[model samples]
Structures are given as structure tokens and as C-alpha cells.
Target: MDSQAISVEILKWMLEVQCKEALVPALLYEKKVRSQYGKAENVQPVKGVLSKRALQVNAPGRDIYGLEKSTEVRYFECPNCERQVAGHRFAAHIARCSGRGRR
Candidate 1:
């Protein structure tokens, strides 16, 4: 595996399953890794708003999690139903929706 590639578990914990102490350092390291790969501009977005680099730029050497502002509802279109599903629940929605024929 490439050294820059993050494991699914780490990525999941960092982005989804909460907890910030580990996330803060992980984000910083992800930035460095992306920079090395020439993808420094967008390692990944924090809540799809600010890029990892932007977060660092906005608050140097501080926890970016503290700076997170109000989050907006994000939706994804379900291919099977042509319905919008909330991002957080899209996985479950898609799983169920995919089994049904399109209306």
C-alpha cells in the first residue's frame, strides 16, 4: 500500500465516527501527505466546506474542529428512486432504494 494512502478505519474515525484528538493530527498529516503527492490543494474537505489546507490556513497550529461553523444539510440523489437523501443516511437509503424499481 502507498504510504500516503489512509486506511479505511482511520479515515472512517477521522471523518465520520467523531472524536477530535486523533483527527486533528491526522488531518495535519493528511495535508502533508497530499502535499507530497501534489494534491495539497484538496486532501479532502471538512464537512464538504473547507479543504484541509484551508482549515490550516484559517487557523494555524490550532484545532480546526473548534472552528467548524453551522453545518448545512447535504443531500445525495438516489439513482434508483430519483429522490434526494440526506448525506448521513444516504448509505442506508441507497441500499434499500436500489432494490426497488424506479417509479
Candidate 2:
């Protein structure tokens, strides 16, 4: 394989799911990036804002229960069917659900 092809393969590997979960955070850490810290240690957020991010960013593996729910999965209730869906799939699910004539 040519050098360009090898580089393309490297990029594709980086984009894989497991690769992304590992690589992205490592890259961010290399750059000393942090989602929360310091002075905000005790600042109270608005009622509906993200309050758990600090726990996540600083303590990624604290979910020793090892269940899927223990992961940082975002959940929301669909207003129409009231089905709880993960935040990542909420939009597509709601659209399909509304098309089914329920919402």
C-alpha cells in the first residue's frame, strides 16, 4: 500500500467506535482539555442544566455497576408516546413515531 492509502486507513481506524471512545479522550487529555473543574466546583447550575458532567469528565469509570445504564447515556421521554429514548436516537425515533399517526 502507498503512503497515502496507509494514512487513509489510519484515519478510518481512528473513526471506529472503540477507537473513537479511546482516542478522542486521549487526544483531549494530551491537550489538557477538561469539561469541568476548579472555581465551578460549587457553583449551582440552573434547574435543568447538566449537573453530572463533572463526575463524567473526571471520573469516567466510576460506574462500577458495569451495566449499560451505568454509562453516560442520555435519556428523555417522548412527549407523545411517553417512551423513554436515548438522547442520540430521540430525534429519529420521534419523527418515525409521529409518522405512525400517534403523535
Count of steric clashes across candidates, in order: 0, 0
lDDT of 1 by residue, 1-103 (tens): 6655657657886666466776888999989998788664545534758766675657744545545454688988988788999988998888677764355
The candidate that achieves the highest lDDT relative to the unseen native structure: 2
lDDT at 16, model 2: 90
Could you tell me which 10 consecutive residues in candidate 2 have the lowest summed lDDT? 32-41
C-alpha lDDT of residue 12 in model 2: 88
- What are the root-mean-square deviations of the candidates from the true structure over C-alphas? 19.7, 16.6
Give a tens-digit lDDT track for model 2, residues 1-103.
9999999998888679678799888978756644444233565678766546554655645543432335578899999899999999998888888895364
Question: Model 2: how far is 75 from its true place, Å?
Answer: 0.3
| TM-score for all models, in order of appearance | 0.31, 0.29
Question: Candidate 1: deviation at residue 25, Å?
Answer: 30
Range of the 10 consecutive residues with the lowest summed lDDT in candidate 1? 61-70
Where model 1 places Cα greater than 4 Å from the true spot, the runs are 1-69, 100-103
